[model samples]
Target chain A: MARLNVNPTRMELLNLKTRTKSAKRGHKLLKDKQDGLMKTFMEIVKEAKSLRKEVEEKLSKAFKNFMQASSMMTPEVLESALLYPSAKVELEVKTKNVMSVYIPYFNLKQEGDILNYGYLQTSGELDISLSAFQELFPSLIKLAEIEKQAERLAAELETTRRRVNALEHKLIPDLEDTLKFITMKLDEAERATKVGTMRVKAMIEAAEAAEAAEAAAAV
Target chain B: MKNNYSIAIVGNKETILGFKALGLKTFNANTTEETVKILFELKKQEIVVDEKTGETKPEYAIIFVTEDLAMGISKDDYKKLSQQALPAIVPVPGSKGATNYGIRRIGQIVEQAVGSDIFKE
Candidate 1:
């Protein structure tokens, strides 16, 4: 820790003491913030992981069905089949602040069923895949929300942790070092002054005694 | 706060149809350039805030990209896009099998914060 370059005066010492107090207070607050951010970040990470696993499983299953359905039909026919979407998945995003991080929440308004394609040449697997996707859409959106939350929270947590570390390791110690150095300097100066005054008094008394002895010898 | 953001998916005709059936706006991206272009376009949306309610929101909330297409986005762009507030870009399984890109990307995020690859063990 580097000593702060300030004049070693009583005024400077008092100012340093106040600064050290506030730095410690700020450090405590930052440490608490770090803990709070960590706790929130952990919760969000766990939720994101589970939700991600579920979404991945559902997506792969849906993709499998899609693969099968696409294999049975020609490219042109498959392209023409799902060209136009039947229903709409209405969405509105809302966000909540978690430890200063804005995490989004999606409100889905599910409308009619997805049945725009005629049931003629389409394979049953296509229907199954489309329905699977339809059902999983909301979950997908939920996954997005949680994952994004995790990302944002993690970032905030990182910054808070770094700040806490700087206070705990660097700034606080530096302040303490500066405070100690100033107090020591002030104490040394005080002692030096005391010694100098005592010597002066002794010399003056010695001179007076010499004059008194001179007077006695003259008498 | 309330927002008018929507989710989107970008991929080929076959891969995106499933998402379209679910009512997400699906974009057909034949090449990596097309996919990246679409993502940039989505990111270009300006955030709108209501003067009366003080509620703020953006247009695109999330964009799901197929892994094959996601692979085309440079690491820099991917990092930049993921680090933003709105429009969380995520990758999912397409017609092919699992790629684990999404899991790995999220793992990177976790590692960046926690200072360890806790996702693996």
Candidate 2:
């Protein structure tokens, strides 16, 4: 693979080295973040599983109670009694930053207070069933929150994981390999120059010795 | 970012085996002594405990334990584990378990209202 022209000079090499180290540090931190997010997601999944179970059970029981109440009373009377006049519940949606990610929160009119209105004056059994449904409402909202957050975090975690893997498994290895190759090439060039200079010096010495022997013979 | 915590499971072969496939670090313990030994090892690594209690704490942000094993553990052990504020200890359904009642219930309501099962396979 074609490596980045990282080390143009000594200063550039130093800078590139620093960047490589920073990239590695960033990679590790992102990996940790990814791991943390996954952990959070797993916890949410577990909670969602259990919460879903609890909510479903309560809802089912409430539904059964409603069915019984409806059957006992006249259908017309039960319809009028069980009718929950829809409240104009307006939600002000806003976003908050959690761990650098923006998450939405629904600001309801009554933030944490339960608003009991339509079914308060109903029959005893019907009232109890409605209260049960009311009790399960917060958990149902919570389940929605957990599931949403889990989905967002899971997506972010997957992206971070991919980036970390790329840096660790591909980019860093390629850069190091290129640096090694260049260093080896430079060393080989230097060695060849030294060998050539020694050969020249040896040739000069041999020529001088032959000339000296010729002069001695002449004398 | 600050601490590195790990989840280690100590249970019968099948229990830990399923968790391993879920990317959890598990320790199989056939005996109580082995369970304690593995728990101690995880503690030393600062992976399981909060560095105070020697018990098997919920690290990894969540711990899954079988209902049978959860009953065997003491209340004090649970209290100490709770202190870490780590992952919640959840009881997973074993093989041959029915659909989670909560999920099924919610799914049923949605299915009825919309004429489609939201959680259907």
Candidate 3:
């Protein structure tokens, strides 16, 4: 619907042709990028789903034990029992590019026993909950990592989709239209110039013929 | 000073108190506002590292929250947080029981990524 305002000249036509070619190439590349981003995003989504399901199941089991422990023991005792955690975790985070999106990687290093409290003071329920949490460390980290990846991929996918749409729907069409307009204008100009040159030639030939005829008559 | 990387648990005092025994840092946020604020804080809570490439990256790896508190977060905030890879915010059932919020979120993610709810629970 929109076009560049410029005189339709050979130079302009040449430039527009090159621009159209580049735009088409750019469109194809962007479309490929969008497809790649979608593929990656879907993979991450699948992984995140399974990971979340497993982690939720385990965590719920742990919470159930915590509930039982709380019911059996006094609130004050439960609080005192888990006052200081027995385990220490060191987490290292890094990012890697998946398609141009940088997604995070979480690595957890856990040290020492997760059961930090004295057995005499804690119930079996407490033990179960603590162990369940300990077992969940890796899943939790993995969930974090995958979820971030999904987010990044999703974001990239959106951007790529926007670009692809712009090229497919807007830029490419505009360029093509502009190219057509310029070519039509240039052809019309060429036709008009050719017609004018033909008319001049015919007139010159007619005048020469008349002069020659006059010379013969004079002779 | 204790460790460069630590896991933080945010939720009700009753629900997350047990996590303290594991040496994890715990924050009690009873209200939605407080929970969102804590999530934001945790999100922003990262250690900046100077890479050899001269780029700085902030690192804070994992965060766990009770499902009830996680639900308290607004949809937009939850979407933003869940999509992030760092400071992974995991939702555990509180003393009450499993709310299935975590699973549902995953299902939603599947739908968003694949354009269909194929991974329905």
Q: Per-candidate DockQ versus the true complex?
A: 0.64, 0.03, 0.52
Number of the predicted model whose lDDT against the real structure is largest: 1
- Model 1 C-alpha lDDT per residue in residues A1-219, reported as the tens digit of each score: 788888888898899888889989988987887778778877878787788888889888898888888888887777787777767665687778876778777777777778678788888888888888887887888888778888888788788888888888988898899889988998999999999999999999999999999999999
**TM-score of model number 1, chain B:** 0.82
Instruction: Name the docking class for model 1.
Output: medium
User: By descending DockQ, how would the candidates be arranged?
Assistant: 1, 3, 2
What is the descending TM-score order?
A: 1, 3, 2
Q: For residues A1-219, write the lDDT of model 2, one tens digit per residue.
A: 667765434455556567678778888888787767666656655676677676556655655665554455565554444333232222333445545555434332322222223444444665555455455544544554554454455446556767888988887776676666656666777899999999999999999999999999999
Which candidate wins on TM-score? 1
Error of 3 at A154 (Å): 1.2
Please, what's the RMSD in Å of model 1?
2.4
Q: Give the TM-score of chain A, superposed on the true chain A, for all candidates in the order listed.
A: 0.94, 0.73, 0.88
lDDT of 2 at B89: 45
Let me know the TM-score candidate 3 reaches against the reference structure.
0.85
In candidate 3, list every pair of residues with a backbone clash: A85-B21, A85-B22, A85-B23, A148-B84, A148-B85
Instruction: State each model's CA lDDT, in order.
Output: 0.81, 0.51, 0.76
DockQ of predicted model 1: 0.64
